[model samples]
Target chain A: MKHLDRREFLATSAAGIGAAALAGSFPALASAADAPSFRPEKDAKLDLLRWTAFVPSDQTIWDENTKKFTAATGVPVSIQSLAWGDIAPKAALAAQVGSGPDIIMGWNDDPFVYPDKLVDMTDLVDNMGKAHGGWYDNARSYCYDQDVKRWVSLPVGCTGNAVNYRKSWVKEAGFGEFPKDLDGMLKLARVLKKNGHPTGFALGHAVGDANSWTHWILWAYGGKQANPDNSIAINSAETVNALEYARQLSETMIEGVAGWDDSSNNKAFAGGRIGMTMNGISIWYNGKKDTPDIFPDFANVTPPMGPVKTHTVSNNFTSAFVFKYSKFPNAAKEYLRFMLDKPQADRWVTEMKGYVTPALKAYAELPIWTSDPNITPYRDALASAKYDGYNGKPGKAAAQALDEYVIVDMFADVCVNKMAAKDAVRKAETRLQTIYKRA
Target chain B: MTSRSPLLARLDSPRVLGYLLITPAAIILLGLLAYPLLLGIWLSLTNATIGKPGEFVGLQNYATIFADPIFRGAALFSIFYTVCAEFGKLILGLALALLLNQQFRGYRASRALMLLPWVAPTVLSALAWLWLLDPQFSAISWLLIRLHLIHSNIDFLGSGWGARFSLIVVNIWRGLPYFAIGYLAGLQSISKDLYEAAAIDGADGWQAFRRITWPLLLPITTILVAFSSIFTLTDFQLIWTITHGGPTDATQVFTTLAYQRAISGGQLGEGAAIAVSPIVFMVVLAVFVVRSVREK
Candidate 1:
């Protein structure tokens, strides 16, 4: 104004811009500050343990979002990432010892396994649901314990499984597109095998991929692990049919399908070894980034429908539990609140490139799904995605069965070991009875 | 010097001093090893889950495990894996030790390089083997296929027997260097005069090995085999990392089975029982080994 120095003029302009930015976000800032439920402890610090993201960009997005929380509130958050399989046992040990991180994210039914040791987060759930247009049915079922009337964990997003296939290979195998039904899928698999491009999914103790697909197939064939009352209902004609169908399908798959884990198919597909496998959008994302030449060759379709019905299992449906032993429960809750807020959640969803199917209804309109046709199938799969216990409520028994690979072993017995389907079903039934009949 | 009390003087005596010196180590062992062993035994007897406190079930877990087929299978497989891997390692290690003991070009360098497999971290080496034996994209498979030895990739870690074979091969590969290096040290210690004396007495190569080399290396070999057996019997990381006792529990050894029961299945008591079941066998074997070694 009056021949001001360069430093003075620059500082004045920066202050003016800062004020304008603050004015725009003042309402949100004021509301957060005024809300009694949002109050954090005076010196709250948090330690959160979560599974390491398969996609590198997802981890980047997670780190960036957590930094925003630390910037907003002067609280430092430490995030410990571990392998997916390690999370359950580690969380169990922590609960048993009555000491661990403040918040630990695990698979569905993890809360039921140690509900007594976890803090009831129903208030946080109610608040999030009210703000985000209510939780999805599968999400609610996975996180809520109706008998106890407590939300032991907060329902977060689930990763949807779909058939990631090579478009070129499918065309070469005389299929213009992916199979829409299980019969067509089997034909396609056989043709792919004939064409030197076999299709496969994990048949072994792969906790995520194999379990999800095997359970989906069982449910599709009208076989249920338990009835509505949660009694053992595994040994049935429907289960035998499912196992037989799986064995037929296994013939079309590669020999090593019995040893495949959650990442095996992804690697196979990305390396141009297999024609198709059921997985999340991570494979597509990986191919898109690392193998750009083959990126366009990759495409995704929803899991094929079985003879009786179309049913698929959501591998993602992860949730976070705040232990009762947390010294700073409020801080953990507030951190989760900030992370699940619309803007932050949308950013994470966007960064994940549709790999994370949102649990909230409001996130259905995220631009990532609308912008890419490949991602829309995953978004749609979320609507019909079923939890671990489809007909029965997910509880400690179901969790234990899943962890023990009882269902996976049943399928493997028929497919890999060439055991009779009936015998396999009986084996699974006996195991389930032992688990559910326990006091 | 100031006069000392009888009690202090007694404590300063060499015999008392020895016990006094070992007290710290004894306390450390009790805290780190002995207490955990006792707690594990107690846990094995209870019906503990992960988070809940278990009551005294009085060996019910043990009885249940003994009746379980998977535990039985794992026990049998553990012995098979240990005996087979130890046998392979001993033979290969002896061959390597004898070869390396001879004078040759780059002998020192070759000897050092031979230790790479044993010196490298087990987990890292196991991961490398996992890649090498991967059903798809395995370098070894590629080589074999290229050589027209096989029409397609071998399912090295897919089948039960294939996985067992792969694990034993890896174990032998890792353990051979240790045995070779140990035997080499023993081989070097055998004086040249003894070999010359044997030669002067009309002893051929086989006779020299039988009379002089075998007797001198017996102590080292016995100790090495015993140590290797204990380690191989309780092996977890190699099997866990490669197969995770999978393909229908084919590769399931004692430790992996215990892990599956206790940690993954949340049946801590059952897992502990499976883990401690091998201790009795190991203890008896140890006693037998000690008696045999001492007698010789």
Candidate 2:
């Protein structure tokens, strides 16, 4: 109230603000005893690196949820978004340099690729599992390392892939409804091709679509990359059969499936050029937004069953890793905790338009799945979904093999290059041996 | 003003001043170029992956890559891509330069417009090309199909030949301007008196171009081709954006293969080995360029 000089005024204001901030934090400090196990360090700051979601709305929801976390807890957060393909290399480089985001989101087997550099998030995993129903088997297999006896990552959700098709076209292709099995699907695809609405899936080096579908086909035909002992098992009769099946299917596909990437099929399906393709729900979500006319014509079904099994691979398993070098491990865990909290999780599911399939079973009941019947198949497909490494654990070797596009290339050799299935399998076997033989 | 200081006198020397002027550039080159180059060479000798500190494995990575079929395929593709793209660019650029060299209306504007493909960022233009060559809804495919020139849509980036052809066409498109502008400068520098003298000597257009223009432009062409070859061989963005060295590794080049091995595959050592393999060819080309430019 007295007449004060400029320096006096500034000093007084600074002290007052500092006191108010300290006072504001007193409740949090006092409630330490009642604090959640994963509470962040006092005044922690965090950096999170994740891939840019295919659905812009999904990213928006993620941003909003992070903002909610920052509002609830005073910890400011910075999010770095990268292209999906760039995420692994960026995360790996960061891990190599030992200087990067506090938390990094990557696909399956990413944590295993740099297990020594990632923090053991066992407590965080146990807490999330206990809080939300329980961890899905696939998620547990992806996150947990038996050798180290620790969870190096927290499995969030998978970007579910299903058969995205033009239902009207399917009906016109001499099929009253979407094909329910592999044989029927192939027959429908042939008819669609004959009618100039060919079904297509990537046969090239698409990390997501091509890899996922190729693996599904391989497993469906009882083909496996390696045995349980990690011995080479790629060159089998089952693998040959799978390749033969894929080659026949490729004959019915668009001319360029051999060179298509993950987005090609999505673009084809959305632009009304292709009859059916395997893709994440974002394709439909995108069609609904940008191409409303084409959107209603689109429908989805669970990936069809093969003779041996009804399994498919989910390429979009979003897993988060807190590096050992992070200055705010507690904060990273706390953020995940807040994100996975039931109410927040439900809102996220709705906001993402069910693009993200829950890793926790309880979140399956979120009304978003039932909101659109087309999206329900994605939820149902979650039951048979497998990560990149199917019969074996998702390890460093699996990550390397997937990144090299070995499986994708193996199929392309048969379908695109006209290599005999036996020869292609032999080549893939040698490549797999080279990859898995390394320590 | 009265007596010069020793330090100032020494600094004022032409040699010292020249070194002083270049010190910043030297430092930048050492830091940005030399250091990384040396680091890459060192990394190639080690068994580096993502996080762990790699131990030296001598020439093991090189040996492994040398034995790899993919590496061999990529090497062959890189050579083919470079030679074909450079040859196409040279021919098209020369034609453009010859046409532009003639006195014509709006020549300046035409010259400026030619730079759009070259001046635009490679990634942006490549994305545009991606849309143009899209297998399903390609504008070019639509045009071709409409004309009944082809039975169905040409899979521009689908098959081995299609992807290779698309890559080369895009490369030529992007690189034509550089060659044209470079050759235009060379063309303008040529004395008009030489053409007049050739005409007086009864040399026809082809003879004049062959005798006068060819000899005069040889040095420039040699340098341009060498440099362009290096650029085309090491090109990553254009190919990475277009095909990602796909269609069964049909379009794989050294740079894309290096990226796949080092970054995507996380075999940093092998990736570096793949990357370093291109240096031998580039070094020979560099020598040729330097020798040609130095010869008067």
Candidate 3:
């Protein structure tokens, strides 16, 4: 080779190296080219407030990804995790005060509550949707603002809810597999109770567990909290039917479940006090990590079909929204984009081990779903799930209904108080009407 | 001494000095107590949610909440909880205080140990009670079962009445130490001569307690009750930790309901209304306490 000038030699070497790297990993390079949704601001440091992770790996993997983002973009980030229930109040207070964490990972319809205070993520979301397999329907319902026609938040993954049961106990109850219909499941519950292996579901003000199962039961029976026209519809015959079904189901469950909180079922199931309960992957994951004998004997299945169709709800449906007050909105958006990118998103979903179902559709093809039979059912949670305040908008009214435990109380009224189903429906309708009417 | 400036001389006046002396306290009261209380009242009068600067809607929030059965239920429960808890704390606390007032071994140690429940963080103690009240694994339930007193687990938090009772019991447990220690202080100040005189006049133990101990202790008891009633009426932590106002809202109180509505439900105005509704009752109690103190 000829002896080139210093500038010429450096230029030639840089071009050759770049070409080789791109060719060797073309897809990675292509994704990298599309990575930054916005340029990082000068001296950008970010603070993110997120709910404490239910799965330990979720926190670890998220922190690792966050560190990688900082390394790549030279933007520092601090993460603050609080109990899941606390995120809503803190986020609301942050919005009210116009200062706090630059970004908040909020649950359910949190973005809806303060859409005006959030930085619009429509551009990032639309681009991500097209690059990925598009957003899940429930994700849009949660993060999109119809009035403003903007994406107020980026949809994070959801914690899927499934019926975690002891396989041996279910088999002993004369069911080879978990029942797949409402009637069959109720029959199994009765049999399990008789066999001294009672079933349980939260009937108290368990913000997550109670709301998940109660909403599913109501929807499965074709009862809607509000009609699509946004009219109150919870006092219908369908609601009464749902109430009756819930009361029957509660009868076969272990006593005192009516007062159970979010952690109660996990404790009860892990200790073998109950044969089955409706919950997320935590119980099974805990058993797998801590109790080998229990882990092998446990199994999970999607909730049984109801009269209308098979319906369920996830315990956690979260979204990340950047606050308008954030001085580094670009950096915040970029961080979310980096996290949701295929490489990181795929890694997150895989490592989560079915604890979190992906919000984007592309990751549904990840091998993690097929790697374990138990993990497979969670993949469909977002697809099968309906957003809160279904039929109507999952807006402030519905959020109020959910937080007030309206649906849970409706079922509990009949099951625990021995109130007539009609009475329970009427009470719930009055409460819902009060909430929705105000809205 | 050198002649002072007119401003300094004026400031030395009693009224000026009184105002000057109280300025810091007034500022503290305004910043800490008055501001929040006023803001809460103002918010209750408006239709404020979380993010929006809401429009004033007068008593619309109050109207809405008053019409709500849940609010009505909470109001009733708050009173029931306060009355029951105060009564239980008073009886048990007075008994313990009377016993502690006697000259005994480990008197100082026992007095300090009595403060454990009160001094420990409420959340931590409530959590301990939560474990004890667990429907399935409750140590209390297990003991009762082992003794063949019951066939099945007692769902301490599962039933409406059971949850209500459990909450009251926990409240009493935590607050008893405060009442006992307070009454003990009053008991120590009482002249032994009164008891001695009553005994010489043919009074029994109960008679001496009714005549001498009762009259002198009334002021402190009233003050203690006033403080505790407010604390008990507005309690959130122990109940939230234990039941979270569950079993069909049997244990719902104003604070929890307000939290559920305002913060969790995002209806700040309605929540503020629920929160401030109890102010009327609290004011009456405050006035009564002040009058009692003055009379004493």
Interface DockQ of candidate 2: 0.64
Fnat per candidate: 0.48, 0.65, 0.82
Candidate 3 lDDT, A151-223, residue by residue in tens? 9999987888988899998998889788888989999999999999998899988988998888888888888
Candidate 3 per-residue lDDT, tens place, B200-269, comes to: 9999998998888988899898889999999999999999999999978899999999998888877889
Model 1 CA RMSD to the hidden true structure, in angstroms: 6.3
Q: Rank the candidates by DockQ, best first.
A: 3, 2, 1
- How far residue A332's Cα lies from its native spot in candidate 3, in Å, is 0.6
Docking class of 1: medium
Query: What lDDT does each candidate get?
Result: 0.82, 0.83, 0.86
Residue pairs of candidate 3 with colliding backbone atoms: none
Q: What is the per-residue lDDT of model 1 for residues A198-248, given as tens digits with 9 covering 90 to 100?
A: 887897667788887888788878788887688888888988988998998
Summarize candidate 2's per-residue lDDT along B1-296 as a digit string, tens digits. 59999999999999999999999999999999999999999999999987765999999998998888988998988988888998899999999999999889999999999999999999999999988988877899898889999877778887888898889999999999989998999999999999999899999999999888877887788878988998899999999888888877888999998988787667788889899989998887678667865684
lDDT of model 3, residue A230: 76
Per-residue lDDT tens digits for candidate 2, residues A115-199, read 8898888877876787677877878768887667789999888888888888888888778888777888899999999999988
Question: Model 1: per-residue lDDT, tens digit, B211-241?
Answer: 9998899899888888988999999999988
